[model samples]
Target chain A: MTLVLESQLPLLIVMLTLGTVAKVRTVGSGGEPGALSRLGPAVLVPGRMQAPALLVCAAGELVLAAGLLVSTHPFFRWGTVAFFAMSTYVLLELRRRRPDAGCGCFGEVSSAPVGWRSIGRTVALTGLAAVSVWSPVTGWAAAAGWVIAGPPPWYAAAGVALLALLSPEIEELIDRVRYRAPCEQRHGPAESVTLSKLRSSGTWRAHHQDLVSAEPYDSWRELCWRFFAFRNHEDDDVVFAVYLSGRRPAVRMAVVSREGSDSLPDYIPVSA
Target chain B: MGHPSVERRRVLAAAVLGRTGAVPGADPGDEEPLRAVVGEVLDVSPHLITIETPGGVQERLVIAPWATAWNGSDTTPGDLSVGSMVLMRTLRDGRVVERIWADTTRITGTILSITGKKDLTVELDCGPHRGHRSVVIPYRASGRLQVRHPQFEPGYLFDAIGIRRDGASLALLPATSQPPYPARSVPPPPPAYAGTLSRIAGTATWSDTFDEEERGAAYPMLERTDTGCPKTGVSCAGLPYLAVGSLLQVRNVCSNRSANVPVVACGCMAGRFCDRCVECDTSPRGRIAELSPSSYVELGGELIKGCFNAQIGLG
Candidate 1:
């Protein structure tokens, strides 16, 4: 029983360290505001005091985690138990006061609403911390022993399984991975890419010398091709239609005379 | 179904399959007949075609009866030589090809140097990864090309779509639109607003270039003389005088989520692209901010959708 209680110390220390780091990191304006401001005590705390309150909570958890890791003293162990008990109470209050807000237990990753799973996880954590209060091993000591030994006791595995089951963040992470933008919504190849393709065609090479200017004064897209118009030496409108797709898209050019006569330019076969 | 890793693997596998099996174009000019499958032609016939992917996989496709092939102009598939690179479009079933293009590629980037008089051999900086490619602009195309590309000097952007011949890209036709100035001489943005504009409404796009996880953004413009702006401002489109490391209060109108992100990079490319985002409604033209993927996702942006209707304020 004492060995199982000792095992709980390492788990409690890990949870506290993770929670503390997450809270501290997210208290900044640039970080995920939903991680702290939209959950936990932030829901109930005054607007001006929210960030400071989050920092204070994180500081308390850090101190308790450090104490639990280094010492097997009754003071540190009991402090962890009381911390988790208070967290459970806070989660319950969060659910009642702001049902839409999350527990915010794990920063932005924990933006799920307060529910039975969240409360149950806190209750289990409090129970685990309470059990550790009677143990004679520090979290570091127990962790070192587990590393040297083959594996942790079965109760440690049970604790991990229970916590994993209650973590709503897992589902959210999975949903993120599963999400894919619809085909039409996904970013298309940039205009630069299309322009690159237009420059690489045979028709451009054939009619290259006829244009008075290198820059197309006007360009527009219609269906599968983009049209570019430049003035020829004769002041004629040299218009080129470049197919937008294919390994070798069709490139065709016609010189529009000043009188609006569209005629294909003199075809000059080029060596490839 | 609830296993995180399992679900992730499944979704990733689906994404990969969707990419490999079929890719319909999403752009305005990317119609069904224009959808391309790029590979080296292994075998070609009036009825059947076989191509080898860059990955060495052999893809055997059926050629539609009315399919047309273009080498320089209209040509028969039988004329395309084996081992020649080709781009083809498929029918609805994605197995029957309707159009095939051959021996085409593009040369675009800053002109490093120009050599020769009758037929110029141009050295081009094709971005960072491609390094440099030597393109020869034939004497016939030089006059018109020179007219459109007035600077024609080093540091000017050169773009042309032409054919691959003799192990080099030939400059055939210029790109549809050209940036008038030299690559290094991007004009400064309009002068700073006369008065403080508290809330500027625009679009927010995302880029993974500068640390995907960093909570920062690339603003379109900053004061040209300011020490914080290392690059020349490309467009006179957005709020001016915003410098690097300045905090911006960005809010996504569609999601109603907001975040304060710092300016980390210059969004010169975004400035040049005068476009609107229709995420919720038509956003005003011009990209105000290009956010890191992390910041974008945190503010309820879908990475694949590309942009969001955004409003920003100085923080």
Candidate 2:
């Protein structure tokens, strides 16, 4: 039973490390508000401070993970148990109050709203951490002690099975593997897909008024992009290329001069 | 892939800011090149290079000894990265490349607001993906821009062709004629032809929204109750009722080329533009079919030029 309890320490360390990396990466590259904003505790933090708060949480997880890997001290064990216990409580509150938001245990991948499976995983992690509070050896020591073992103890197998059953992210991994074909090679998107993406792009809206006719004069696809051309008010060709993949397909535009030259005269800046 | 060097970025920044000494002269070619090829670079060699054009055709062009390549600024052809988008100008031979612009970027959107007293700064709403961006209209170009864009207010649309510096887009040249009206006031299109016909005579276009090898057409008109169709009203008047898998016998009036293609995707977008095609002669001002790139080429349509006067019937 001691060995089984120690074995769970590595699992906690790994989960903590993953969470730390994901959170830190999200905070480092600033863009849209991350999954942290959707978590229940977000209401307590200002929008500008959300990233910093996520970084702080990640720092705590890293410290706990590093502490558990090298030391079997009661303090480290108890801290880990407390961390997961707090996590379980937070997830429960999120589920009850903001059912539409995720616990944000991971980063963007955890943006899938609070679910029974996520809460179950947190609860199971808390139980695992509680059992590891009595471990006598560090996570690294327990891992080293498993040299050519006949089989893991029944409890280790049971713990792994429970964690697997509670992890809904596994289905996404399976789907990715099942449909691994490149975007262009797959049965391409519908015409409406490219058109809608083009319409939503900044390039389209900017040049929309200059178009001579209401509809695109010509359009064609090449690889992962669909190109649409329209004559501008100046009779020059205004062409747009919409990327055929991703949630927001990238759109590009080029205006060919009526004389067919690729170059447009430079704009000479002067006081307005 | 390797990115444009910092020195090149600085040069592009200077060029965009209208400080012109760092900018290089245009590619050493005729004033008017026959074609401008836009595509992603696939393969490159010292003497030869290949690119997948927007029409999905892999074009192999001879890299002229004098061919100039620019990413953010003047660069060597060897420095061009695979998978980077490029705009190339070919010499008269139509096979030898004379110029290449790599990773060229463009910005088009509505002017949300304007700031700055000397060098005017314009904030643009570049739609959802790009969100908002701020561009500097260099003092040198401000006068010319204001003359062209008279109503440079918040509601009017703005456009510029430029390059990306770091992660931000820098607007270099006006990409299109600026309309004086608000973007929301685009003139309504003439009503689409609503009547049905057995043989539709109109412009046929191509879209790359399908496998390159697949031969098919996306008919603008469909049976009202067809599964997989969004149940939108018929897109064009001349189109006959067609199903998803129906066959279309298409002929290009200009080339006299013909083929039978299947209906593989939707052409709801094509129905919106009621405009004529003057490829050979004037085609009726409504799109009848949107063909896959391969099928479009097979029916003697040049993908870059965009359309062909087409006649189609149920096959």
List the candidate 1 regions with Cα displacement exceeding 4 Å: A29-36, A177-272, B1-315
lDDT tens digits, residues B147-214, model 1?
Answer: 76777889777766566776877776654234565565443333333343468787887654554225
Task: Encode model 2's per-residue lDDT on A13-45: one tens digit a residue.
Answer: 888999899777766654323335664445347
- For residues B168-231, what per-residue lDDT tens digits would candidate 2 score against the true structure? 5555555434655455433222322323344768888765455534567777664333324442
- Residue A26 error for model 1, in Å? 1.2
Could you tell me how far off, in angstroms, the CA of residue B77 lies in candidate 1 after the best superposition?
60
**Candidate 2: C-alpha lDDT:** 0.64
C-alpha lDDT score of every prediction, in listed order: 0.66, 0.64
Docking class of 2: incorrect
Fnat for model 1 comes to 0.00
